[model samples]
Target: MLGISFFSVVSFLLVWELACRNGVVDPIFLPAPSQVLERAVRMFTEGTLLWHALASTRRVMVGFLVATMAAIPLGILMGTSQRTRAAFDPILSFLRPLPSMSWIPLSLLWFGITETQKYSIVFMGTFAPALLYVIDATRSIDPLLIRAARNLGANRWQVMREVIMPGSLPQIISGFKVILGLSWTCVISAELVAAKEGLGFLIMNGKEFFQTDTVVLGMVMISLTVLLTDIVSRVIEKRILKWQA
Candidate 1:
């Protein structure tokens, strides 16, 4: 599988490079892989590429972590209680439909042009979805498990700890992996306006200068970063979900 993937990528790049060289595609619009690599090397040597990547990564992690921390307990509560779910349903309905970009103006007003504003954008964008995922995961737990725990003289808290939490955890983790990727999109929206450094900023800057190679490099960096984070998430998932294996 790895060999096939490698061969496919190599073939695609060869075709792309040849198309540019043969004038079948405009270099200004879509540069060759070699040109994108050159831009990457230049950015790395100038010490901007890593900085931009780290900036975006930091924003994503902070925002995502905060969202997860808040969402889990609340979602569990809502999932377990009809009243709680009813109370929050309207608010979730309102927030869930809104895009990350829609919050930019309010976040800027609330946090100025600071890093907190960027974090807020990511937080707002991801929090509702993460909460919904957790709620669903929690609610998916078998009623029989809860009843069995209760029959064994387990209290509310004990039942939750022994039955609901364990039952829901695997699905929650899977949902969180997806939300982590969504956080990247939120961070990009955050950076596009007020950020001085981030892949989104790098891409916008490249566009203003008509440096298509730099723009492509920025996109590639985002994809590579997301891929790296997904690998890490998979490792962590394995560790946490050993029972599943």
Candidate 2:
């Protein structure tokens, strides 16, 4: 599968490069693979690309960790206590569908173009979904399991810490992997507001200068970063969930 995937990507790039060289596709619109690669090298040499990518990565991690930390405990409470769910569910529903872009005006006003605003964009975008994922994961654990824990003389906190957490963790981690991807998207929107450095800013700046190679380079960098993070997440999941297997 890995070999096939590599071959497929190489073939596609070959076709793309040939098409551009033969003028079937305009370089202005879709630059050759070589052209994009050249641009990548130039940016790397100048150190701008690394800095931009790092900025976005930092924002994503901070926002995602904050959201996860807040969501897990609250979601566990919501799953176990009907009254708690009732109190938060209404507002969460309202906030869930709202895009990160929608909060830019208020975030800008509140945080004034600082990194906090960028992190807030990511946090706001992912928090509700993460909360819901945690809630569902906890609730989906069998009630029989809970009863068995209790019958074994486990207290509420012990049942939660030992039984509930382990039972629900696989699903929670899976959900967080998705939410981490979402944080990257929100960071793009975040960097749209007065950010001088980030992949988002790079793309926007390239557009103003009509540097299609830079734009494509920014996009490619985003795809690579997301792929890297996904791999890291899978590694973490494997280690943590090895017991289940």
Best candidate according to lDDT: 1
Each model's number of backbone clashes?
0, 0
Q: Give the TM-score of candidate 2.
A: 0.98
Candidate 2: worst-modelled 10 consecutive residues by lDDT: 188-197
Give candidate 1 misplaced runs (Cα > 4 Å): none
Q: Provide TM-scores for the models.
A: 0.98, 0.98
Best candidate, TM-score-wise? 1
lDDT of 1 by residue, 60-167 (tens): 999999999999999999999999999998999999999999999999999898999988998999999999999999999989989999999999999999889989
Candidate 2: segments with Cα more than 4 A from true spot: none
Summarize candidate 2's per-residue lDDT along 1-245 as a digit string, tens digits: 99999999999999999999999999998899999999999999999999999999999999999999999999999999999999999999999999999999999999998999988999999999999999999999999999999999999999999999999999999899989999999999878667989999999998888899999999999999999999998998999899988
User: What's the lDDT for candidate 1?
Assistant: 0.95
Clashing pairs in 1: none
lDDT of 2 at 5: 100
